[model samples]
Target: MAFPRNGLTSAAPADTRLKLKIARKWTSAEGIVAIDLTASDGAPLPAFTAGSHIDLFLPGGFTRQYSLRNDPRERHRYAIGVLREPGGRGGSAYVHDRLNVGDLIDTSRPRNAFELDETAPFSLLLAGGIGVTPILAMAYRLSSLGRDFEFHYCARSADRLAFRDEIEASAFAGKVRFHLDDGPEVQRLSLDRLLAYRPAGAHLYACGPSGFLDAVVSRAKPGWPADAVHREYFANAAPKAQSDQPFRITLASTGRSFDVASGRSIVEVLADNGIDIPVSCEQGICGTCVTRVVSGEPDHRDLVLTDRQRADHMTLCCSRALSAELILDL
Candidate 1:
């Protein structure tokens, strides 16, 4: 490899942490609310790309991932819109009810699991319900770049839709399309019709409830490339306990050991024994609770680790020990 003429230079490391406070809150729709945040200490914020997300550390040791709905160019603050699913899991429920206006929180610096693929000649964005969060950023970027991109925002009704007026008022007014289930049949988003309109060199990004994403996958599978289809699942069932069998954890660095109950997570067991592990996402989707595994096999249960990462290391927040006895780094 050749070095630059201005002497050896390395790329700047990405910022991976943010200390922020809830700056403002507004109800976007019937069940959705938007939360804006800013640095509590007036420090410079990190830059992020479209389709990025931040790991929010909520109270009661709960961590969840939310996409950055606001534009990434504005660095003074960040914003995210969350839907309160009453019948769903507890994360959104707590954020809607318990999170106050001035609460301080720790967030992982923006990470992009879904990125805009600019190489394509054009793009098609399909958002089901709150899945619009990530794709909205893509729409903003595409509009700014003068690219040919279209968006289909689908929801049950107009009142349930998020950012309806703002999106319609933007420059993307002509490019954006709304599909309501209660509207006329021709106005609803049709998988068959969308499939027929698929253009060459167009990437399709979809996110939403499990059923919606499943339909997209079922309809677009045989024709779409693996990289062309991007999806995120919002309807994940809470992870269950391993079994009734108990296990022992030995701290390799400190030569200390502890017993972990079958129903308890490694984080819970360690916290009970005075071990503090900094974590944000407890569902295993965020790599915040990653710890070195000294010995013994790990029973991986989290979605954060890739197949290759699971083969190498493990997440301690949700992943538990599969072996009867295991060794861990402090």
Candidate 2:
């Protein structure tokens, strides 16, 4: 299955179903496990740039996205760090508890939406908790390209910091700053101070909890150009209260009508009526379920769609109709 150009896809082509053996696995930090995957036959794996992530197809019909944390320059293997989320839907738990070295797993070809802008005069990287996975890859690529950059890694504690020793020992060690929540007030990250001075042609990239990303973007929005600030959310934003209202949906292709009741989603309603929509990350973080809007206004609950995209398309999984009725391209 070919994925849309929008970047998220589930049914990839056969060749894109890259299977790799877990070459190594070890604890990287508190509640974090780092797994290295290499081609089963020891051939070079697919090449990916910094900030690229692959969809890991785990057992029990679970598919999860994990950022490649290893240096992209190395084509031999891909490394990903998994943080065990006790509250999550069980993907991380399966990775930490069941996966082992020498096991083979299927993965999608690398896809990247959080690409690094090499043209920027300077770059500031902000990471919170396990969000450092992709940012670490960017730091390595930036260092190798001799680009001007600084990385601020924030964690609840020094012990909980993943890849702390590796980062501190790297050549870019001087350019990296560690911020611990348990530290003194002066040592904690000050978003205002860090983003106070916006340099010419500088760009800011952040990933972490939704609140952390929101804080970074919120602070930078007033000073920096909208295009200069970029972020990726590792988790879905908190859901709003149970205020969903029933809405009508019209399929532009077939002129079919469906009713999406309160506490339900467009995808669910359509699927129940024998309509299939490709979807991943039903919480709306991934762009897989985006569909074009022919008419009517959308509630726009997804985090992946940009301002421009939202004008024309909406994520079908979680987003609903703001208007009484919505017409979808289907």
Candidate 3:
């Protein structure tokens, strides 16, 4: 999927939707199902990098993002491993219980926020639970390129590890390590030891549950440079704040103003005023509704934006204004 490189906000067109058929589906591990999607016409699908993900549009107006786990070198199909979240908002449950092989579904083009730094001297890839999807793709690319990399996978138990068989059979199996929570203390992952030695020109990437990711990042902060540590979250760490103050937003393009009430989002206010902003995950985890800020400070609540991105842009889905009013480049 091609997007503007200038980091400016623009509405997504309806025609960008792609239809794909489930070519194959099987269980990858306990509570995990691997699904292979191919173009409905049997034509080549768009090429995606290691950490790219496609937004799957499900029934009941649900849109969920899933990381692509297939090897980047392959173009026939895009593979994704989904963990059934019975407690989640219907998306995962629908995917596990309702979706099936040969079913046609709509998805957005692959977008990558967790890109691998191929020029690095060494790479440290970390995964926790079902967060292994993107890391598995990165490992495959690194192995194929013969890059110096180490993949550390952590799970609660041996049976809960997804893609265990694939990792064991991979050509770079020797560079991979597994840590199980039920295993001995010595066999567990030592974050202290892992972050102590900083390999020159090495970059670290991690994806997993919020607590697991926080542990890796907190440990790496004292030793690793800010630019060298990359991470992707499957969900937001903190819940929405209940003390959001009402604010006014002015659209730069049309000079239109809207009043955002407490307990309501900027996007909702815009939509109520006949303005439409393309959005996927309303929880602010995905970067779909990111809009540029022309003036006023924004109280950014999205997990998708980095510190740099927060200076000039804000995700309209959940973010509010820190000032009395905000001017946006809508």
lDDT of every model, 2 decimals: 0.73, 0.83, 0.84
Error of 3 at 316 (Å): 1.1
Model 2 earns a TM-score of: 0.87
Q: What's the C-alpha lDDT at position 288 in model 2?
A: 65
Q: Which segments of candidate 3 are over 4 A away from where they belong?
A: 1-14, 183-186, 239-242
Q: Give RMSD to native, each candidate.
A: 9.2, 4.3, 4.3
Off by over 4 Å in 1: 1-17, 183-186, 237-330
The candidate that wins on TM-score is: 3
Q: How well is each residue in 1-330 modelled by candidate 3, as lDDT tens digits?
A: 111111122223548988999999889888999899999999999899998888877777666788998799888899999898866767777888899999999888888778899889899999999989999999999998889999999999887899999999999899999998894532689999999988999999999988998899999999898789988887766676545999999989999898999988888788787777877666566687898999999988877777888999999988888899999998
Q: What pairs collide in candidate 3?
A: none
Instruction: Using lDDT, give the best candidate's number.
Output: 3
Error of 2 at 120 (Å): 1.9
Model 2 lDDT, full chain set: 0.83
- The RMSD (Cα, Å) of candidate 2 is 4.3
Look at candidate 2 and tell me the lDDT of residue 116.
88
TM-score of each: 0.70, 0.87, 0.91
1-330, model 1: which lDDT tens digit per residue? 000011111111225457799988889888898898889987767888888888676566455678887766778777888888676457788878888888888777777656788777888888888888888888888888888988998899888789888898888879988998884533688887786656888888887776887788778877876567776666333355465467888888789988888677777788788777755445554455677777887887765454565664777766776689778777
